[model samples]
Target: MIRVIVCDDQTLVRTGFVTILDAQPDIEVVGEAGDGLAVVELARRVRPDVVVMDIRMPGLDGIEATRRLAGPGVAEPVRTLVVTTFNLDEYVYEALRAGASGFLLKDATPQQLIAGVRTVAAGDALLAPAVTRRLIGRYGSRVRAADPPGAAGGGGANRSGLAPRELEVLRLIAAGQSNAEIAAALVLSGETVKTYVSRILAKLGLRDRVQAVVYAYRNGLADEMGEY
Candidate 1:
């Protein structure tokens, strides 16, 4: 089973998420928290496979909680998917930089919510390509000058480690292409594309495609690739 911890400031929000998650036989809601501090305690206790986090909690907040649970400093961080009611571009960027595995609107349909959990639980990312492009372009442009020489504002390390084909895969990832789509675009098999994607993640030390998308945009790689 894919164990999950749902954290939100509102009791109803937590209960609602638990309800949706519990219906999935593959997913189990091991715990719930009404605030960020409680989230940490519950997560440590449950050791869930994924965390559905809310950003505007009363204390600590989702971003910091995400960092503590999944950021670069953690030795064995858990995956966190940000599920928030707000659509602030800045919050989205911060959550990703703090090591959130994905983002989703709180009002997302039950299917979307379930998909987000499974995606993160499987160690993939949940942010769609268009949303990634929009969020990164919106937030990244404002801080381009302040960003590292080639670093994305999302705090992804330099991506020089990526191989040429891996870079191609990364570009397509930012364009919102699935493994099959990328395979078709590059004339490679879907399985091959999947392998390249795995290599891309390992070499970049990234958690999932969301960060890869963020990396591509922050470094201008996505723009050069054009749309697929």
Candidate 2:
């Protein structure tokens, strides 16, 4: 079973999500939290496979909660999905940067919500095309953004460390292609695409596909390589 924790400030929202997820035989709502503090406590105690978080919670907020659970310094990071009523560009960008594996609208369909959990659990990202484009355009244009081509710095080492094929996969991922879609597009098996994606994430030191897509757009890989 895929154990999950639902975190939101609103009681109705939390209850609704729990009801929807508990209906799935393979998924269980092991715990629920009404705010960020409760979420941290429940997460440490439960160690759920996935956390459906709300970005606008009182206290710590989803971004910091995600960082604590899944950011670079965590000893054992848990995968988190930010499910919020607002799709603000800044919220999405910050959440992804803080190590969230996926983002979804609170009004997302039952199927979409379930798929978001499963996708992140399977080490995949869930960046809808509109969200991807919005975040890329918003954060990419910010001042002091790192230079994509020379992002690795003085060593000329191409610090991204991705090979040509892996680069292709990253571009496709940023363009919002799933493993199956990428496989069909590149004329490879889904397994092969998965392998390439894994390598790309490892090479880039990215936590998941969301970060890879962020990197791709930030560094101009998406623009040069074009869309999915």
Candidate 3:
């Protein structure tokens, strides 16, 4: 079973998410929290496979919670899926940069919510939708906002580390191509594409697809508009 914890400041919204997820045979709502502090503590105790987080919580924000759970240098990173009220909310991008595996608008359908949890639990990112790519673009500049002066563009050593085919896969990933679509585009099997993606991410030291997209944009491997 995919154990999950639901974290939100709103009682009604939290309960609704718990209800929908618990109804799935393969998913269980192991814990629920009304704020970021409570969620972070609960997650430490539960070690859930996925944490469904809310952005606007009191006492602490979801972005920081995600950073604590999954950010770089974490001893044991928990997979986080952030749910927010607005697709264009800048905080959502911050949460992603903080190491969230994915984000969904709170109004997302129950099926989408369930899928988001499963996607994260299964170790696949939930940011493949083209619309999500646009959200990334809106803040793509922030990824490189602090770059050193004269930093060369276009992935430099990052591109050099990848084999030609792996480099192609990385570009496609930044372009928002799902594994299945990439497989078709390259006339390869889905498993093969998945393998290539894994290799590319490992080579680039990206935590997930969201970071991969950000890294691509930061290094000019992909354009801000998600075009390769």
Task: State the weakest 10-residue window (summed lDDT) of model 2.
Answer: 147-156
Off by over 4 Å in 1: 142-161
Error of 2 at 66 (Å): 0.8
lDDT tens digits by residue: candidate 3, 1-228:
999999998899999999999999999999999988898999999899999999987889899999998887789999999998654558877887888998888779999999999999999898847566577667766665344112234456666787878867777877778888888878899999988888877777777787877676666666623333
* Model 2 whole-model lDDT (C-alpha atoms): 0.79
TM, every model:
0.88, 0.88, 0.89
How high is the lDDT of residue 6 in model 1? 91
- Ranking, TM-score, top scorer first: 3, 2, 1
lDDT of 2 by residue, 96-179 (tens): 878898899877999999998998887777887656776665675452335332134421244347777787888888877778
Q: Once superposed on the true structure, which residue ranges of model 2 sit more than 4 Å away at CA?
A: 143-160
Alpha-carbon shift of residue 213 in model 2 (angstroms): 0.8
Show pairs that collide, candidate 1: none
**C-alpha lDDT values of all predictions:** 0.80, 0.79, 0.81
Better of 1 and 3 by TM-score: 3
